[model samples]
Structure formats: C-alpha cells, structure tokens
Target: MDADMYAEAIEYELLTQAIYKDILAREGVNTVNVQHNVSIVGRSGVEHQVDVYWEFKQAGITHRVLIECKNYASNLTLEKARNFFAVVHDIGNCVGIIVTKTGYQSGAAAFCKHYGLALKLLRKPTERDWEGRIREIHIKMTPRVPVSNETHPIVCCLCLRPASEDQEVRLKNSSEQNPNLVHASPSMRFLGKDGQPITEELRLWIPRQLNVLEREDGGPYKKSLELTDHYISANLGNGIELVQVIGVLIEYYVETLPSNEVVLNATETVSAILKDFESGEWEHVHSAK
Candidate 1:
C-alpha cells in the first residue's frame, strides 16, 4: 500500500477502536477484551484480517464481534458490503460491523441491513454538522490581586517608639505564664488577652481598618491600628522590656488584573465524530491527549 494509504488505514482503525471502546463501556461490558488489527481463523480454516475485534463470555458462552474499517473518500459500495457479509457468515456465530469515513451507498446499506450487518460512519466534523452547535467558546477571566503600596513602621506602646525599615518586632503570646516569642504575620495563631486565638479576628479587623484609612485619606495613605487589645507584647531587641503593641502599619489596594480571553475550538479538540448509518445517532469522541 502507498504510505498515505497505510497511514490513513491505521488512523481509521484507531478511530474505530476509540468509538467501540466507549460504546462497550457505556453498555456495561467491562470484562470484554477488545483488540485492534488482529486475525481470527474462520470456520473454513481461513484466517481473516479484522480491524477491530472483541470477545466476552456471557453465561459460560463466548460471544465475538468483528469490525472492518475503510478510509475511502468515496462511499462504500454493495460489493464491499457483500464481502464483509461473507466474512461474517464464514466466521459463524460472530457479529460484524463496517465503519467508513464517507458513509455507504444506498445499495450497500440495503445489503448490510438484509444481512443484519452493522454499518457506521466516522470522520472529522464538517461545517454542516456544526449547525446550531457550538464550534468555539470564549471565556473571559479577570483576577483581583492585592497590591501593597506602603507599609508603616510598627510602634512600641511602652517606650513610644517606632521601628525602622530594617527592624523586625518580635511578638510574645501573653496568655501563657511564660509567653513564647512568635513571629507576627496575618496567619499567626497568637492568643489574645481572652486566651482565645486572635488570628481570625485580626484578619477581619485589619481589612476594616485599611478600608477606614482608605476612606479617610481619600486615596493611598499610611495608617496604624492596634491589632489586639493588650494581648500582644512586642520587643524591639533594643534593651527595652517587651512592651504592649500599640499599632502596626498596613497600606494596600486591590488591583484588577487585565482580562484574558480563552478560546476553545471543537474541531481542534475533537478526535472523531462517530455516526450510525441506520439510527442516524452520532457522538463526538474527544482526544485523550
């Protein structure tokens, strides 16, 4: 066979395999073994090449099914249908199906129907098939991200001093008799004066305070608010005793990210479209890749 012809034939066999596998799964035939490009010996001792084959045992009896795939640009004819019927008849006690890309002639359809052989069409979708169907979809995504413009200096209430840019204030949990030093952040689980975790309370209070500052300043501005009431003690590590935390600086604004449009096309994503010749029912098989 020509290289193009061989490639097309292999593609058709793979498409048939994908369609039948999904069909078998939907029909609840999990125990069946499906094979591609296999040969089975007929009752007359002649080995026949099968494009797709599956076998399963039901009630101790083995049932077999065979499929032939044709990658022809033209419609399948009566001769091809008769040849497939003969193969199925000689094989005996097995179901036969013919899958083609362009569909079958009227005579071929009649012949297959008379012999109880199945005929199907599987191919890439065309413009006509996409009528009233969504060919492509666009989705707009916008993200709101918090942007910090300025962070004010932390103030120690005992000595009435503010920390420098390179300085970090260590916060101590006052609920314990010997309070443990802990790093201060929005996610810290430090205890308040009431001996309850004030992390959640601080998260809510900080935003409210920032909003108040934004409203008062009418724009970007620096503001400080006490995080918790007498529960948090801070040390500047400058020989001063751990003093109560008066306030911490927080200033930020929310920036909306640029909107992005994502486009998804059905034709590019769909692997194949399987259509039954007789029933006219169809299904879109998406690529697993």
Candidate 2:
C-alpha cells in the first residue's frame, strides 16, 4: 500500500502541529497543543469553524490564530481551495496562516493571495528543522478581566445606554472595541434600533424578529412608540409583556462613573451589555434560561 493517501494525511496533520509549536516559540509564547478548534465570525457575517486555532498572550494583549494545512497529492481543486477561504474577516486581528505540503487549490490560492499572508510550505523535516519543530501547539486561555463591585457610572457600549445593571457582583469595564451579540427577535429589533446601531456601529445578531422596526430618520423620531405598544398589547410569546421602561441602559453608564469623573467613557465592554438594560434598584427575579 502506498503510504501517501490516508497515512500521509495523518502525517501531514502531525507536521502541521509541529510547525505550530515552533511558531509559538518564535512568537515568544510557551504553550503548545495540537488539533485546536475555533469558531469565529467571518466577513460574510457567518460563523466559520477552523481546524487549528493558536492562542497566546503577552503584556495583557491577547492573540488568536487560525492554521490551515493542505495534504493533497495534486494541486488544490476549487472545492478544496474553497476550504482555504474558511470565512475569515480580518487576518489583522489573527495570526493568520496556512500550512500545506501539496499547496492549495487555485481557488484557495487566489483567495489568500492578498491580505499579505503566504501559505507556509512544509517539506520533509530534516534534523535541523526537527529541533525547531514544536512537538505540539496548545493555546492558553486569557485571564478574566478584573472589575470592581462598587457601583459607578457605567454605560452600555453597544446600545449606548448609560443605565446598565451589574449582573455579577462586579460592574464590568467598558471600551470602544467591545461589541455585544444578541439573538434577533421582534422585541430585540426595537431595542437595537432605539440603541442607534448605525451611529454606534454596533454588531447585530439579527435573525429575523418578524416584527415592525422603527427608526428615527432625522426627519422623524418614532413618537408613536408602535413597537412598545405592540409588545405590551400582544403580550405575546411566553412572558414577553412590555414593562414600562423606567430608564434605559444609559443611566447605568452614568452611575458607574468614578464620582469625580463627569463624562462617561464610550469604550465597549466585551462580555455583553444586554443584561444591563433597564436596571433600577429592583429585586432580582430568577428566569430560567
């Protein structure tokens, strides 16, 4: 039996892991584990799962990497090459790479031609390359960011609401780079619209809420409160009655300020800003997820 078919695919995957290990060393990272998997959003707004994801951290900045290895006997075909596209949005944010012994399908090659990254080709490892090859590539999880419990003026980075509630014991820090994700439904569309997504450039996980969405078009603000009336009137879909909005997430942002600080910072918080909507000194209610 020729060893290049099934046997070679396995061997190629092994070599890919070896290269990943050396990459960590080159990047000043210490951990390595193989067969890493990652699911991240692509430019197409669809989530893409990757074969190998490399991760590391230094001086508090975190890094995520995606690795693609091709072990085909012939030049890559369109379908196989299409695999190389794998729905990546920004390689700038990732340590993007491809490892192929036989190289990519023309389609895949053309896709990755730009973005300033070249696929790294791996030949048979020699004794010299063996020392450089890392036995494995495992990523380290980043530490949870530290937040304080003391209630201060906090703002919703996504919806831009100053009124936010602290879910855990501590109030999360806010930053501009942070984006929030919420499953789309009718009620959520209204909320996101009121949140001024275009101005904030907020990320919307909108998946057809099947409800009327109102937006303030500069010429008109949604004075009718049609959405509010709809949710309140229909009271539809399992415990979805509209409670009178006491306040919005903006207030919480205001309160989370360091007493002396007047202006609230607009940095988006990474964890999530949804849970903080409409928090007044209300008693906690347990809702089953």
Candidate 3:
C-alpha cells in the first residue's frame, strides 16, 4: 500500500468499470456511469467520496454499485468492512463491494456474510486471459511478400523474420552492446508503400505493470535486475514476452487478477492499427497464445 500500489488500485478500479461496460449494455442497462471520486449524500446528510461508483437504470429503478479498493499488505479487517457496510446502508439502493489486493480476514468475511457484501481479491492480469483475442495470421516478408499459409508463425512486420527470433536478437545485441540496456534497442525500419524504409518508432511495452528496463535505484543499465527479481518473485508469472524498442509504450495488456478482468489499454484518442496486408485488415498474431 505504498504510493505505487495506491496508484495501481485507483487504476484497477477504473479498469473494472470499463471491462463491465459492454456486459451492462447487453443486460439492457443503457445509462451506465462508471467513475471515480464520486460524491454521494448519505442518509445522515453527510457526503462521502467513493473510490468507484457504477450506476444504471432499469425499468425505472436505479441500481448502484459502489466499489472500495484496498491495496494493503495484510488482509482486509472486519472493521474496514463494517465501515463500508455503513456507507452502503446509508447510501441505500447500492451493492457494496470490497476489492482488496491480498484478501479479507476471516472476521471480515464473516462480517460480509452477515451484511450481504461482496469481496473480491484483486491482482494484475495474466497471459491466460489474452487467449480468445489471439488470432493466427500470416506474416509478410520484406517488400511485403505475404506468406501463403495462414497458420504460419507470425513474423515481425519490420524484419520479415519470426517475431520471437527478431526480438531475441535485438535483446541479445542490446545487452551485448550495453548490458544495462536490457530490452531497449534501436528502432526498427520497414519498407513503406513508396518502397522507402520507414523507421518504426512506435513500440508497445508489455507486462504493463512492471518497471522493467529501468533500475529501482535510478542507476545505469538496471532494468534486467529488477525484472529478473520480479520474475523470481512471481510478479511476472504470466509467461508474457515483451520487446523494448527506441520509441514509446503504445499498447498495453492489462488484467486485474483474482477477478480475471482483462483490458486493452488503448484509447480512442490514441490507437494504432497495422494494415499492411493485401486485404487491408489488421492481422492477428497468435504468438501470445
């Protein structure tokens, strides 16, 4: 429950609302509002700010879901649950939920049972959740030569080589050049439609939550050590492979653990679609599977 953990909790709460937006729509809840820092007037005429608030109307009835995010090192205690229950009761017409990083204590669970409150353990998402989005697509070679087989292993759109192999070489070469560089490498270039080489400065940083390629101590070439330690600690247990390039971390793959809520971190204001194929469609690379 340090600063970083608090920030992560806030982000997770927002993410939860987004992930359920579509489902709420399907349930005929058209006026769903999911937001943070919501102020509500309780029955005692006092206002309180909630971490997350989800509300929708159905059949002239208002339904509200209030979520409290707790990123504590230890289990949530019964006292906290009682305070939350009080807020929910005062608010009225609301389902109360406590999302904790670790879990709830036995006493907290008992309190929740008695009060009909829901508890959810939260963690970062894993690779297993990205399966359905995985698609098999053919890769193209240099000069945009499409591979005939659709099920072929996807190639790096830049080097016209297996993406994994290309990434390995890039990482190896960077580490060799400056062992501290870990995943940071020079930007890749590809041939544009005009037959000229186009430098791909747009790159995605994977394992979204990790501070890889950077040292916790703010020294030189320190990313690998931190990332290695995280892997050993089971922080990055998702079997996710990430590539670092000389650009930006554009795409994000995120999941809230225990809840198994998955989200792609791309906004309508900022998104990139690869459409180099003849059909002019985005190709799905099944490498993540």
lDDT of every predicted structure (CA atoms): 0.68, 0.39, 0.51
lDDT of 3 by residue, 184-217 (tens): 2334332343434444432322223234323232
Ranking of predictions according to lDDT: 1, 3, 2
Off by over 4 Å in 1: 25-31, 145-255
| lDDT digits (tens) for residues 1-289 of candidate 2 | 4765767666666555655665566677676544545676765566776767766666787666776656665665556544554444433356666655445565656666655335655553333433543435444433221121244322222222222243111112322222232112223423332333221111132212112123211111111111231111112222322222222222111111222323321221111111111121111111112
Looking at candidate 3, the ten consecutive residues that score lowest on lDDT are: 226-235
Compared with the true structure, model 3 gives a TM-score of 0.42
Selected candidate, larger lDDT, 1 vs 3: 1
In order of appearance, the predictions have TM-scores of 0.61, 0.34, 0.42
C-alpha RMSD between model 2 and the true structure: 24.6
Candidate ordering by TM-score (highest first)? 1, 3, 2
- Give per-model CA RMSD: 10.6, 24.6, 23.3
Give me the candidate number with maximum TM-score.
1
How much lDDT does candidate 1 score? 0.68
- Indicate which candidate wins on lDDT: 1
Candidate 2 weakest lDDT stretch, 10 residues:
269-278
The residue-by-residue lDDT of candidate 1 on 45-86, one tens digit each, is 999999999987778887779899999999999999998888
- Displacement of residue 105 (Cα, Å) in model 3 is 0.5
